[model samples]
Target: MKLVRYRPAAGEAAMPGLIDGAGRLRDLSGHIPDLAGEALGRAAVERLAALDVESLPPVPGQARLAPPVAGTRNFIAVGLNYRDHARETGMAVPAEPVLFSKAAGALAGPYDDVVIPEGATQVDWELELAVVIGERVHRADEAEAARAVAGYCICNDVSERHWQMGGTGQWLKGKSAPTFGPLGPWLVTPDEVGDVSALAMSLTLNGEVMQQSSTAEMIFPPVFLISYISRFMTLEPGDVVTTGTPAGVGMAHGRYLRPGDAMRLDIEGLGHQRQVVR
Candidate 1:
């Protein structure tokens, strides 16, 4: 099932929802509080999947979407996890996953405007596959880590390269800007997603293809990354770990985003996201 969090109108509280078989949005608010915390666990998700989708009230007209999962305490990220991405930057592939964190506040609706931080130069895009953890786990094995996943979604790991590489070189500074993390269209379950490794993903800037690759290119896939991360920090339900982006970032071609530039990111099965740079 495709779960979502959305607002019926501006200033309204976000309500839990799902996309039914007919591709219509149906309300799940009565069944759950929000799509976060324990609601993201495997057993909880399975219970939700059993509900009669058609009987739920339809969310009329267009509602503004929020990131699929909420109450995320840790918004972790992997860097140089994609081989082509590493190559494009002339950086050596790390034997282990290079991890970083994006402030949870940076999360935004998929179609929200990506405000270019003031005085920022070298604003860029990194289209990534985001994983939402379903249960608390630490020191998990690959199989256990795999089972801990609740769902997947698309994430735009928008960046400010100058802050990322300049000064003391703290990656979080460049990655944690407001509106920097645009996620979701839906939080698709694992059963529906099938083979996560084979999904095709890409990003287009102003209608032109900029990044294109498959999860198959990832050096440390989701399960491995999850397990690796668990060895250090305990991952909780609703926590998000964004697997790194593919090649073709703006930095490689000196084509950073400017005001009015639009980005559309697509990950197979997870759905797509559109954001206008402002």
Candidate 2:
């Protein structure tokens, strides 16, 4: 099911809805008591399935979208996990998963404007597969790690090369600008999406393709990534983990985004996103 958070053009309120046949959206929040935990689990989905979608309220075409998940505590990310991306930076392959965090406030809807920090010259885009944890997990094994996953979503790990590499080597400092993390058109559950690694991911700037690669190329796959990160930190419900991006970022080519540029990103099975540079 394509779960979304949206508000009609005439209203500013946000609520959950499920994308239905014929592109119409049906309200899910009122139908499902809880969007988190078991309410989002398989049993709850079965309960939702028995209901008549036509009975639910219809969402307006002019609705403004919000990121699929809200109130998430941590937004964790991996860096240089792709062989090609690592080679582009001339950095050695990482010995372990390179972990980083983006402030929760950095979260923004998929189609929102990506702010070009004033006097910032090295802005770039990294299309990644973001994993949304559904259940609370701590020190989980691979099997448990997979079980803890709620769903998957797409994320543009927007970065500033100058801020990322020019000053401190800390990637978070360069990554955590406001509205930097644009996530979701939907958050799809595992039942709907069969295999995560089989997905293809790509990024286009101003209508030109820049990055294209498969999640199959990822060095640390989602299961391992979840297990690796859980060893040190608890994976709470709604906490997000963005797997690394593939090669062909603008920064690697010394071509950065300008005020009028637009970026469109898609992760197969997950959905697509559009962001305009401002």
Assess each prediction's global lDDT (C-alpha) against the native: 0.93, 0.84
TM-score, every prediction: 0.99, 0.93
Error of 1 at 146 (Å): 1.2
- Per-model C-alpha RMSD: 0.8, 1.9
Steric collisions counted per model: 0, 0
Best by TM-score: 1
Tens-place lDDT digits, model 1, residues 1-278:
99999999998888999999888999999989999899999899999988878899999999999989989999999999999999999999998999999999999999999999888998999999999999998999999999999999999999999999999999999999999999898999999998899799999998999998999999998998999999999999999999999999999999999999999999988889999988
Off by over 4 Å in 1: none
Best by lDDT: 1
Clashing pairs in 2: none
